[model samples]
Target: MPIESPSRRHVLQASLTVASSALFARAGAQGLTGPAYEVSPWPGPLTAFSLVDTSGKTWRPADFKGRAVLLNFWASWCEPCRAEMPTLQQMADLYGPEQLLVLAINFKEAPARALQFAKRTGITLPVLLDVDGQAARRWGVKVFPTTLAIDRHGQPRLRVQGEMDWTGKAAEKLIASLL
Candidate 1:
């Protein structure tokens, strides 16, 4: 491949600086969810996240800025993930206006199954269908209920793998502060 010219490099750097400065606010992942598991400081934006929710509307990740966001990868087959749905719904109902977006990306599960699970479990959290599983690959999500907390500026603040009491008081305070 040919090398970039000086001017091109300058432009690339400038764009990176801007994306970085603004993106400093948030992210979520697949392999492991938090800063502790990030292989690099720059993980890039969580990719191509647009899915229809229960209400038959499209949703995407970028829409969650200006508030704390949670990105969670789950499957209908995962019991712990199912168990955590109500708590997540409670949080969404609680902090949604403050910009707390919870994107529960259904991994490899049929949209119908995910839809059924959400309704059966009273999971009011917005569910995104990861049909190609590319979102999971991009986020490096290896386990169920892997969660990343993205701040108001859209930076990844906390990442937790495995099940968590997502609506607990401590979690509420941390997420609220980002608003």
Candidate 2:
């Protein structure tokens, strides 16, 4: 019998499982009956990013300085991501781009596939391509459908892991705080 080291993939998977379980447990303990938005006040400025959307427009955090930004990291294969997308679009419509900008960052997916999903779902939100997943990695997005809410001054306010109804009361409250 030989002692073998765990592979990198196994280690990463185990880490993610533990993290997700802990997050859910914390949410339950907090009596979070509404949407689970983990209040994460960033100690510093917003994370720097430069990504291109499906329409080939380069976007950066500074580009949307005066408006609250919702950065959603999603993939076409994620069912929850697919389900929550429409609500995100609705939120964008409700607030308008001047007040709130919702950018859908596709995780490690092809631009064509993401564009197809947007077209099929009739989503009008700008779909940014994270082809190398660097943006997600930079933002520390380990879970699928993680959304970070940034305030008008380009500061991160809260992070929500998993799917959430953007039209719900809790979501409205969160959005209100950002705006």
Candidate 3:
């Protein structure tokens, strides 16, 4: 059998896997297992946004008023983003939309692609489309899977800058604080 050379996609995937493993290992070693939470990063009004969900319903900050909101910025191609999605859905299910609104804002991806991922993954949370990447930029989400927790009063409270198990105790406590 001839030894086959790896394709660009395969090589990139391998590299990303290695990099992610190393990053997680280093973080674990330093006892940084959960997402990095920044309290009062905005310290003011919630960042305004008007995006449509997979169902073509427009969502705005006002739509989530009086409920704690988790605005998760993610991309279909990001491994961490994909991994954390289930936990996000779990969180959404646990709290219910009336109390905690979990919005998965697709970062710089087409609505069709985002909807496809959601359908394929059985994601019940509202997947909002940020096709132009403007929403992510406005929210200051430079990293994939970054989540911002907004208080019931529509004030941005916490900024989580990585993937996390939303069902975990640390995450539970952090989210409960918003409520």
Candidate 4:
């Protein structure tokens, strides 16, 4: 008998787990200490990509130059992503428009689903639709709640795996350090 290949969701989950573990290990080695969020700095410049929001607005890295960015990749079915929505909203309210830019990238989901989820959760932050998961793939996102902090220069400074308390001091400290 032949073994069946894992489903895409299963494969994604496994790869995300391994990648997250590696990110944590590297963070530990770098003497990073804080909350459960892992911080892995990008070695070089950020890759360019574009995705449209539900409003048919396209956003790219260049669009947010000179401002810090909180780039979150999520899906409507993800519990952690759902749970973190409020905190993300808080972050947006606290440091937005002029200070920080918060973008929630909906992965491999329809615009309607994402829009409904955002509406139900009252998440007013910009929700960019990654309809085909291509943008997520390019960003090396294998998990539901992967978040990256991009500095003013449009470079990724840290990648946080798993859920995070965006309204908390640790997160504030991390973002403040970038700004």
lDDT of each: 0.72, 0.88, 0.85, 0.83
Candidate 3's displacement at residue 159, Å, is: 0.5
lDDT for predicted candidate 2 compared with the true structure: 0.88
Clash number for model 2?
Answer: 0
Q: Model 3: which ten-residue window has the lowest total lDDT?
A: 35-44
TM accuracy, model 2: 0.78
Q: 88-143 in candidate 4: lDDT tens per residue?
A: 89988988756899999998887899999989888889999888888777778886
* After superposition, candidate 2 runs with Cα above 4 Å error: 1-45
lDDT of 3: 0.85
What's the residue-level lDDT of 144 in candidate 4?
69
Stretches off by above 4 angstroms in model 1 are 1-44, 54-56
Whose lDDT is greatest here? 2
Q: Candidate 2 residues 16-98, lDDT tens each?
A: 99999999999888866565444455443466778999999999877887999999999999998999999999999999999
Instruction: Show where candidate 3 strays beyond 4 Å.
Output: 1-40
Backbone Cα, N, C clashes tallied per candidate: 15, 0, 0, 0
> What TM-score does prediction 3 earn?
0.78
Q: Cα miss at 32, model 4 (Å)?
A: 18
- Candidate 4 error regions (>4 Å): 1-36
